[model samples]
Target: MWPEVKIVHGKPTHSQSQGSVERAHRDIEEMLGAWMDENKTKDWPAGIKFIQFKKNRALHSGIGRSPYEAMFGCPARVGQASAGIPHDLMNHLATEEDIENLLKEMEGESNDLEDPNSHGEREDEENTVPETVDAVRTESNEDVVCGQCYTVLPLGEEVNNDGKCFNCERQGNIVNERKRSRESLEKQATKMLKLSKKKFSEVQVGTTVRVPIPDVDRARGSPRNVLAVVGSVEDGLYKLCMCS
Candidate 1:
């Protein structure tokens, strides 16, 4: 019983795992040019661009330092995280308790109304009717904020912490429901504004693009010949200009 079968063992010319490698190589070759601006700059080594192309094809790095690196052990730069969270997200990360107190003080308050700086004396309800109490309650009810929708929902749709609204319909996760006040919503509104401002801040310094104007703007009903500088607000929601 020396040898039962002919043992064939020699250096293989090509790798047995070559199929996947060839397919991957083809795909990478196709994607190897014009995808590398600042956005793809982290994949600089394999990024390719022609003189005609302002940008180059980018490569995915999944092992060096970015999420790609951590997940795949590849050497690629991490994509930007701040892109999803609005630019001013840091300022609005308040606790639930703080939001609740702020809403009570702003209930039924008109947009132009001033904040009550001093605690005024309580009003006497000696002659107050049930209807008046109902109205007051109705007005105050407008202050609650829906964590899902973020903004304070309509009065009739205001949801409690259980995530059930006044109409008894649930808008989101009951467990994730929040008890934010109008004041908190207002603060969020300001942060939204700042976030929007930061979005416009990306317009290159002293550079401009033909952006659409809002009908409610200075050149309402007419095309606005305005600067594209910071805060030169454009209404991306509409097609205002003639060429827009």
Candidate 2:
């Protein structure tokens, strides 16, 4: 006789998932409160993105890394400048020489920018679809003129085959762009982290630096900002002293 397999549960009311979730909820609440106090805004929904960014970039004690790094296998860019960008990405996107060339090229063009919100606004009156241009996508790489202004699109992916570019098509395209941006940022952060480690070895005993004080609050551009000089180096650690 084949006995029916009985399902055994751990406990009547046992759930370990609540632990992480509760901790995350508490952290998010604290962050949201701080942000609201700082900005004087009650827009919780809008502030969620800002909170998520901080949480993702922040280092986690349990994981010994940031959440972004754990998920992407790369360091997260919290708020660093071009010092954090990797050489590969910098070269791939735009090098310093490329920027110089672009500046030189722009020198000949008019100073008037494409600013729509300027004092003297240049409004586009032709908002309606034109009759001559075909809005729908006909082929894989066919050139389609914009129905609104009759301007030829740079690429075929600019508009969908249904002649609707305002909603899903544009939103999906933006999402793809954002994803690529995140990947680039991750690579940059990882490379910069490595470079920063190497830079620590180059620091001499007399090198002066601005040492960040933990749990200290000060106004912007305050005189109380702490400056320290490296006194000694031991086991890859810098012993710093307050600068006179």
What TM-score should be assigned to candidate 2?
A: 0.30
TM-score per candidate: 0.17, 0.30
Q: Kindly list the per-residue Cα lDDT of model 2 for residues 1-244, writing each as its tens digit.
A: 5489775543344256686787889989999999998999888888999899899889765545666666655566542232444344445545677655555555533344544454243333233333223444443336655554555655433655756454544445555545655676677778877998887657888988886533234444656558888899898788989836
Count clashes in each candidate, considering only residues at least 3 apart in sequence or on different chains: 17, 0
TM-score: which candidate is best?
2
Clashing pairs in 2: none
C-alpha displacement of 14 in model 1, angstroms? 3.7
